[model samples]
Target: MANIKKGDLVQVISGPTQARGGDRGKQGKVIEVLKAEDRVVVEGVNFVTKHVRVGQTQRGTKTGGIETHEAPIHVSNVQLVDPKSKKPTRVGFREDKVTKDGVTKTVRVRYAKKSGEDL
Candidate 1:
């Protein structure tokens, strides 16, 4: 599983999306996860060409041509957003090591550096 999963909101920090992308770079929700390639598809960013249908079943209507749609970006290029600050912040996992029934294990939790808050 990805350290960051689908449904998590994030900010694109690199590639075609950067400070230059402005509000377009402000916020995006993660819609898909691609672990093998370390990439995630943001809801409305990184568009690319796609063959499309104007209307799939519009009886005699002409089918649509190719259109653009969001493409995937590497996870390393995106940072989990900080709810309070509304800024792209890095995520750090804090593991609490404990012993139960004479067995030791760790529990991990996410944290944000900007506000020193645990997410």
Candidate 2:
């Protein structure tokens, strides 16, 4: 299982500090997870500009130009935020027991190691 998932809050644990105009310590929700590349695109982080060829849509609407958007960052550079503490922390998994309709089942749950709270 991945430590970080789409829609999970995360903070950039690496990179230069804000004073240096870097994304270190910035917190944002995970917009997408690039599992194949081991990178994640966090909302409002790692902004990059892309230039594209100008074109027109089938409806005659102009499209393509310089656009800014969040770029994928290495997964190791981010850590999951602890809900209770509201701080970045390591994630851990534990077995959870659930009983429904007299059927007991074990499930793995993600939790914040720092606050010992389930995420």
Candidate 3:
């Protein structure tokens, strides 16, 4: 079960920035999910630098030199931001009852543990 998903707002609880406490308590939207690596790319978080050669590219002229971008952070190091409280909150699944075509069924829905609000 993936507790965290793309476009989720998350706060960094711990990671490489722990040394400087830079990324701690920082919140950002999840840009991508790497299920296999158990990591996630958060916007404006976990930045990394890479050197590249300037050249022409499909998008446009490549002016490459020490390019920086967000790197993947471990999912365990971040927590979902609560919509109501706007703080980090644990996620839980709840079964909601619904009727369709004269049939009643229950579906799992994600909710915030702190405020018990739908996520």
Candidate 4:
């Protein structure tokens, strides 16, 4: 598996209008992961539009708007943003040596290179 997983915080690293200084380093949380295409849908990020059937569909949640957000960005294009400093950071995966279980299991852990702190 890739180093990225759902519920992880990430940053807009490379993309149109995001490659430059403005939104390049803007932080967001990883909401979904499309592993087949190596894509990730960040929360409140990479917004797009979609048509919704008003009141015709109910998924046990509130319903609104005919056009909705729909955008799935490439996983490689985004970098994991550090939660503490709120800056873009690199993520690395290794066996969790200090896990409660005696068995070995790999975990997608991150460490801020600039701050030198484990995320």
Candidate 5:
């Protein structure tokens, strides 16, 4: 199972600090997970520019221009944020017993190692 998933908050842990104009300490929600590439796209991080050819939509609306969006960063470059402390931390999995409709089942759950909080 992946340590990070869509909608989970994460922090950049492998880039230069903000003082150096890098995304080292920025935190954002996971927008996508490219499992095949082992990378993730985080909101508000790794911004990149894309230039599109000027064109018109079928409805005659102008389209295409310089646009900025988050780029995929290597999965190892980020760590899951601890919900309790709001800090980057390693992830660990443990079996949790959950009861639904009076039926108990054990499921593996990911949690922050630092704060021992669910991710």
Candidate 6:
């Protein structure tokens, strides 16, 4: 399982975005996780602009113009933010006993290594 998932808030640790200076320590939510490519699209991060043909349109909607959106960043470039500390921390899995409908079993749960709390 991926330590980072969709909707998880993350801090940029290192990457192209970090190299730019301003976004080095910025934190944003994960918009999409590309597991196969081991990359994630964080909200408001790694923005890229695409220019379209002026006369392009799909159906009744305009499809031509400059569009900006978040681009995928390597997973290693981000670190999960600890909910308790509000600081970036590493993620680790732990076994926990969970009971559902009276059936109890051990399940692996992701936790913040710094705070030892379930994520």
Q: Please write out the lDDT profile of model 4 over residues 16-114, one tens digit for every residue.
A: 565442445657778789988889888777666776655644556656576756378888778876667777677655455555567765565555455
**Best model per lDDT:** 2
Clashing pairs in 2: none
- Worst lDDT 10-window in candidate 6: 15-24
Error of 1 at 74 (Å): 1.1
The candidates, ranked best first by TM-score, are 2, 5, 6, 3, 1, 4
Q: Judged by lDDT relative to the true structure, which candidate is superior, 5 or 6?
A: 5
Which residue pairs does candidate 6 place in steric collision? none
For residues 3-107, write the lDDT of model 6, one tens digit per residue.
999999899877555555546688999999999999999998888999978674556665678989889999998999998888899989999999999999999
Identify the runs in model 6 with alpha carbons over 4 angstroms from their true place: 16-22, 55-61, 115-119
In model 1, the Cα lDDT at residue 103 comes to 98
lDDT, candidate 2, 44-105, per-residue tens = 99999999999999999999999999999999999999888988888899999999999999
**Which is superior by TM-score, 1 or 5?**
5
Please give the range of 10 consecutive residues that has the lowest summed lDDT in model 1.
Answer: 15-24
Q: Which residue pairs show backbone clashes in model 4?
A: 50-68
Q: Residue 101 error for model 3, in Å?
A: 3.7
- Which scores better on lDDT, 2 or 6? 2
lDDT-better candidate, 3 vs 4: 3
lDDT measured at residue 88 in model 6 versus the true structure, 0 to 100: 91
- The RMSD of every model to the true structure, in order and in angstroms, is 4.7, 2.8, 3.7, 5.1, 2.9, 3.6
Better of 1 and 2 by TM-score: 2
Prediction 2 TM-score vs. true: 0.92
Weakest 10 consecutive residues of candidate 5 by summed lDDT: 110-119
Candidate lDDT scores, in order, read 0.76, 0.94, 0.88, 0.69, 0.93, 0.86
